[model samples]
Target: MRLPKTAHTSRPWRIHEIAGDFQVEDVWALPTPGGPDDLAHLVDQFAQGKGEPIDSPVARALFAIRWKLGALFGWDKPDGGVGGRLTSLRGRLPADLREGPKGPDLTAAPFTSVFQTHDEWAAEMGNRTVHGVMHIGWVPDGAGGYRGQMAVLVKPNGRLGALYMLGIKPFRYLGVYPALIREIGSEWRARAGQRAAGSAGAAGAGG
Candidate 1:
């Protein structure tokens, strides 16, 4: 579900340290609820591309259209991406965070991991339109369990980038994000079911 920007800003996330100049474009409550240690599993799912909602036809079509547009316009040229037109956020990391696990290389997205901690993981990507950060945190649900929260932060390139973000806002809210939430929930449930089945089989073997 879409959340207020405070849902991300209010937290003590390490992302705040490095991405202060970027604006918070969106915040979402992810559906992957679990115990404290489960953030790693959630991050793994993302890195493996198992939880991306782009598999949904609508989301896939939208992404394909976006990529085609980018290709035609030179928006995604290598020179426009991170480490080219934009400096990587990794360069801004503090000493401790820089030395920590940089998380896994994502198979689904162009984002490169910046840092990872027990409860937070951050990755970044850039193009002609913007330099963006995807920050995920495991937060207490107030009901004892913990769930994932995602925040998107961006520094737009200029007028073109601002207009592009404005143009896509409707489609993102109406189609992409909803499908993303549903897919993540479905994948999380499937993983839970597999774990349960494995435990049951182990119990049966012991019996």
Candidate 2:
């Protein structure tokens, strides 16, 4: 569910310190509800490319068109990515965050993990369009449990980046984000079921 901007901005997230210059592009109430410790699990699943793929046929078509357009326009080349045309936020991390666990290594995803604290995890990605941060936070649901919240922060590169962001805004909100959220919810339910089955097996063995 798309959340109000204040859902992220009103909080005391560490991301606010470093990403002051970036715009809060989107905030969403993730469907992965669980205990506090499950934040890391969610982060791991994301880093491993578990639910990031575009599953909807329309979304997949859009992705295909976008990638083709990127290739034609040299939008996703190495020269347009982090450490080339753009700088990584890792260079701006304080000493403590720099030396701490930088979360998991991504294999097939565009994002690379930045930092993983107790209740938060962040990853970063950059392309010709924009340099963006994906932040996952664990927030209490007032029922003695917690749920996941996600915020997208982006610093658009230049005129091209700004235009690109504007172009994709509608597709993202209507097609891509919805598909991705549904996939994440499905994966979370599957994982929860597996854990329950494992626990039941152990209990039966003990009995």
Candidate 3:
């Protein structure tokens, strides 16, 4: 579900310290409720690319079109990415964060891990249009369980970048995000079922 910017800003997230100059583009409440310690599992799912909405045809098509456009326009050239166009957020990490788990490399997305902790994970990606961070946090759901929260922060390249973000805002909100929410919810439930089945099998064997 779409959340107010405060949902992200109100938290004392490390991303606030790292990406202070970036704009908060979107905040979302992910439907992946579980135990407090489940954040690691959630992060692992993302690392494996299972957290993405790849099964959604609409999302798949949009992604294909965007990549095609990017390729045609030289928007995704290596020089326009992380270590070239923009300095990596990894360089700004404090010593503790630098030494901590940096999460796993994402095979599904072009993002690179910045840092990871017990409850938070951050990754960064950049292109000609923007330098962006994907910040994921495990937060209390108010119903006694924990769920995931995501915030996207971006630093646009300039006038052209700003225009590009503006142009895609509608599609992101209307088409992409809804598909993502559904896919995440479905994946979360499937994982829960698998865990439950595993527990049952263990109990049966012990009996």
Error of 3 at 159 (Å): 0.7
Steric clash pairs (candidate 2): none
Q: How far in Å is the alpha carbon of 146 misplaced in model 2? A: 0.6
Better of 2 and 3 by lDDT: 3
TM-score sort, best first:
1, 3, 2
lDDT of 1 by residue, 9-74 (tens): 998888889999999999999999888878888898888774354657888888889999999999
**Between the candidate structures 1 and 2, which one is better when assessed by TM-score?**
1
Candidate 2, residue 76: Cα displacement in angstroms equals 0.4
Measured over all alpha carbons after superposition, the RMSD of each candidate to the real structure, in angstroms, is 3.2, 2.9, 2.9
lDDT of each: 0.90, 0.85, 0.88
Error of 3 at 59 (Å): 2.0
User: Hey, what RMSD does candidate 3 come out at?
Assistant: 2.9
Q: In model 1, which residue pairs have backbone atoms overlapping below 3 Å?
A: none
Candidate 3 per-residue lDDT over residues 1-207, each given as its tens digit? 899999999998988888999999999999998878788877877777653546777777888889999999999999999999889999999999999999987877898999999999999999999999999999999999999998999999999789999998998987788887777777788788776686679789999
Total residue pair clashes for candidate 1: 0
